[model samples]
Target chain A: MLTPLFEAVRPIPAIALVPVAILLFPADEQGIVFITFAAAFFPIMVSTRHAVRALPTLWEDAVRTLGGGRRHVLWHVVLPGILPGVFGGLSVGMGVSWICVISAEMISGELGVGYRTWMSYTIVDYPAVIVGMLTIGLLGWLTSAAVELAGRRVTRWLPRAEEAS
Target chain B: MTLGITLESLSLGYARGPVLNGIDLTIRPGEVLVIVGASGSGKSTLLRALAGLLPAHGGRALAGDEEITGASRERAMVFQDDGLLPWRTVRRNVELPLRLRGLPRGERKAVAREWLARVGLEGHEDRLPRELSGGMRQRVQLARALAGAPRAVLMDEPFGALDAQTRAGMQALLLDVLRDTRATVVFVTHDVDEALLLADRVVVLGHGGIRTIVDVPGPRDPAADRTALRAQILEEL
Candidate 1:
């Protein structure tokens, strides 16, 4: 909702939001931080809810029979059960946040890879913009990959694809 | 033994549906009681009521002076399937109840190993439930129930799913475990041979309540004395 409104004005793309951010909040780096947070929040929320809902009833009953109180069951059994889903959500959210931050800087106001990319574009410096994009892609890929790896490690109880083979 | 169970006007069913109606029964401590019934006659419901897993919706279950309105740690249940945690190794699964009870690590592992060894699962501790044969997983479930050190164990068709030979072996193994531990056991099964093999008293559930709770004076060896006892329980069924 907020993104389309921010994007309506023409000369600046969303990416330019970073550079002018310093002057708007000169004492603290609040604006850029808030923008990054907004980009990653929703996907993480939805994925985690999906993970929690998918846990088997038997697992929950087993925990209860073992004398786990509500809190213990939620933290130890429920949380671990849904971790892969939550991590998947977080990874997607984080990757999108980084990708859009660069794009936001390029299109909108001031500092960040996006702003630098747009500046290069204005000067007809295509290679610099390409470099900005490659950097964003690499960072996003690495972070998402790291999250997926962590999820696999945590859900080691599940049957692995190799083992099934 | 001082422990005994009684249910007074115990009526149990789902929110609206009926399973048991105005039922009353008594089980002596260290006694092996088997409940037999037709399909959906509530033999399993009786076990659940006995274990305190079933709410009255209408009736009351009492273990001596204590009321069992919900599941209690003092009783453990073994279902038809091995209810082993797929994620944990056999040893870890057995150790779970102890860990939940706040038992220290060294002691919990030691107790877990002893119970595993007793159930003939000594070397299979590190193996996950899926890696083991069905019989082995059932033994692990048995070990888990025993490891909790419950005063009574509730079994709902514990060996009903196994093949004939495996079922016989599991029956023998279960009797050995029960005899060794002397825990009061409430077993629910439609299998007459199984009931004759393990139970000291066979309680048939029909006509809404305990049709009969018969005492069988036979040798503990099911494989040995089963010919006569099996016929008797079959007649009762």
Candidate 2:
């Protein structure tokens, strides 16, 4: 049910929804939150669903035949099976959310790097704007890196596909 | 604790229609029964039914006197896909059934180590499934199916992915493991030679039913006799 809704919204950039969020939410905080949520939610949900669907039926059968109960299957099989995909989505979502959040903040906010960058531009403080841009870039890279690190830790058993060569 | 299996006029199907029917079969304790058929002949359906992985549309599946309404830990399965949890190391995959049975961590680790070594995977136990070759992964799967010391093991094309030489080696390894464990085995494969090599009795399936049951003369038949049996089975097909 939610899959269809996400599929519909997946193609549209969350930044594009900023205008609708501003109109719907009374507070700037709420609008920014909504934009960020929109940016993050779809990728995570879609990838998770895809992971579950892509799982081979043979895996479940193997678990069941081994006398694993429903709870056991979920704990041992399904949860571990989807972790890599979930982490992948999370990393993507973090990047996307930072993009949308900064855009929303820049358009209308009193604080944050985005707001400061826009404010400096208005005052012709070009170096300050460059500093703000650098700051946002640094923050986005750090957050994404953190997500990647978590992904690596959780999915340690996964073969390093990128390092196969 | 070896177990015999009995199927009584079992029928199974998907939403569309019946896939296999009238499967009244018995596998003696410690017996290896290989089901062989053409692709899409519902051999897998029959194997799954016997393993209690499929719902019976009609009739019954039993592990001895116990009615098998669903999969049980007593009847472990080695799937064609290997079914190794990609997130788990080889040892963890082998120890999976032990974990499901609620064995304590130390004992589980010990059992997993023992089985991995038995399967010639002692040093490779820490590797993930994807890091191993197809044959190595299959050996892990075999260890996993038997590691928990289940009474019966169900196999679906267990060695179908291997090269001829590797498949031969695996067949030998499988025989050795089963000899030691005495677990009732029901193996499904399309390869006639594989069925003859591994089975006490080969069940030839056609049109969703058992066409014939061919008894192999010995554990490892001579090459000439093996060829003869293969030709005969091919004729039956």
TM-score, one value per model:
0.85, 0.90
Question: Cα RMSD (Å) between model 2 and the true structure?
Answer: 2.7
lDDT of 2 by residue, A1-165 (tens): 675776777899899987798799856578888989989998898889888888777778878887798898788888988888999899989999998888988886666889889999999999999999999999999999999999899988776867676
Question: DockQ for each of the predicted structures, in order?
Answer: 0.40, 0.68
Cα lDDT computed for each candidate against the true fold: 0.77, 0.87
> Interface root-mean-square deviation for each candidate?
1.8, 1.5
Candidate 1 C-alpha lDDT tens digits along B106-213: 999999999999999988989888888888888988898889888888888878788889988888898878777888888999988677777889888886777777
Best by lDDT: 2
TM-score of predicted chain B, candidate 2: 0.96
Query: At residue B122, what lDDT does model 2 achieve?
Result: 84
Recovered fraction of real interface contacts per model: 0.40, 0.91
- lDDT minimum window of 10 residues, candidate 2 chain A: A1-10
Candidate 1's residue-wise lDDT over A26-105, tens digit each?
55546566556656666776687778888776666565666666776786578777877888888887786777666655
